[model samples]
Target: MSLKITFSLTASLAVLLSCAAKKNQQAEADCPPKPCTMEFRTVGVVFTDSKGDTLQVKDFSVTLKATGKKLPSGAEQSTDAANPFYMIASDGDKSALSVEGDTVVVSGTHPSSGQVKKTDFVISGGRCECHINKVSGPEKIVF
Candidate 1:
C-alpha cells in the first residue's frame, strides 16, 4: 500500500512538471522577437571644466545605490588626452540589472584637482531589452 502511494505521488509530480514546462514554452513563444543592432552599445559621459575644456576623469566607477554593488568599468586605461570619455555601462553589462532596475552613481576624480564628482543615473535594461539607457543625467558634465 505504501509503495503504491509513493508511485502515485511521483506520477502526479511528473505530470505537474510537464504542464509547467509546456506553460513556460508557450510564454516564450508569445514573446515578440527583439531586434538588436550589431553596433556595440555603451553609455558614456564626457566631462569638462567650467571653461568647457575637456577634463580627464580618472578611475571612473559605477555603484548600485540599493545594494551598494559596484559595477565593472570598461574604460580604457590609455593616456589619450583627446579622449576623456568615461564608460557608464555597456550592453554586455545587462546581466547585473534587475527587472525593476536600480539607480547607479558614476563617480570619478579630476586629474589635476583630484576633486571627486558623482553623477546619478537610472539604468534599466535586460538581456531582452537589447540596449542599456541612461534614463537621467547629462551627456556632458561641467565640473
Candidate 2:
C-alpha cells in the first residue's frame, strides 16, 4: 500500500512539472525580444487648392505637425522646403512622414500676389489630401 501511494504521488508531480515547462515555452513563443532601437515615422502630405491645381513648395509655406493621444493639441513635426516649391508647399509628395496622428498647417505668401494664406489639414493615410475653397471670402479646406 505504501509503495502504491508513493507511485501515485510521483505521477502527480511529473504531470505538474510537464505543465509548467509547457507554459514557459508558450510564453517565450508569444513575444520575441526586440533590439531596443526603433523609430516612429509619419506620412507625407500632398497639397492642392479648390481649383485642383497642383501646388509647389514655392507657392506656399507649410508646417507639418504630429500628435498622438498624449498631445491631442498637436505639435510641430517637420518643415519641407524644396526648389520649385510653391512658396514652401510641395511640387509632389513628402516622405519620412510618420503614420501616427499628424496634422499639417499651411500659411504662405502667394507666389504671384504675395497674399498670405492660412489653413490646416489632418492627414490620415497614404492620401493626406487637402483642398482649399473660398467660402464667404475665407479660404477653408473641406474635409
RMSD of each: 10.9, 19.3
CA lDDT of 114 in candidate 1?
89
TM-score of each: 0.68, 0.27
lDDT top scorer:
1
Task: Write one digit per residue (lDDT tens) for candidate 2, span 1-143.
Answer: 99999999999999999999998567546444535323333223333455755344233434664432222222222454331222222212222233342456565444454556666554432223221111121233211
Q: What lDDT does each candidate get?
A: 0.76, 0.41
Screening candidate 1 with a backbone cut-off below 3 angstroms (N, C-alpha, C), the clashing residue pairs are none
Cα displacement (Å) at residue 120, model 2:
0.7
Q: What C-alpha lDDT does candidate 1 achieve relative to the native structure?
A: 0.76
* Candidate 1 lDDT over residue span 29-120, tens digit each: 75568777888777778888989898878777778888888866444333677966777777767767654566888788888998888888
